[model samples]
Target: MAIAWSGSLDFTVERSGKSLMGSAVSGEGLVNVYQGSGKVLLAPVG
Candidate 1:
């Protein structure tokens, strides 16, 4: 697997006791996960 991109990628993933919620996000350049970025969506097929 090859990862090709520029800029900085920062994330502070954590867990709080009992929880099944996972937060997935995505953005580029000045748009960061902390400086107010967009969200990534994941779907569960039924």
Candidate 2:
């Protein structure tokens, strides 16, 4: 699998205890996740 974004962007990813959250931009659209723990969240912008 692959994630691609156009141009350039800066983002911060934070993890507390067992949770993770971040915001990112992809060629297809916006990508984000909040309060995620112990697993992977894959969202396809396309």
lDDT of 2 by residue, 10-41 (tens): 43344323323322222233434334234343
Candidates in order have lDDT scores of 0.32, 0.36
RMSD of each: 11.5, 14.1
Of candidate 1, the 10-residue stretch with the lowest lDDT total is 23-32
Clashing pairs in 1: none
The whole-model C-alpha lDDT of candidate 2 against the native structure comes to 0.36
Q: Write the per-residue lDDT of candidate 1 for residues 1-46, one digit (tens) a residue.
A: 1122223434333443233332222221222232234343445555
Task: Give the range where candidate 2 is weakest over 10 consecutive residues by summed lDDT.
Answer: 19-28
**Cα lDDT for residue 33, candidate 2:** 35
List candidate 1 stretches off by more than 4 Å: 1-10, 18-35
Cα misplacement distance, residue 34 of candidate 1 (Å): 7.8
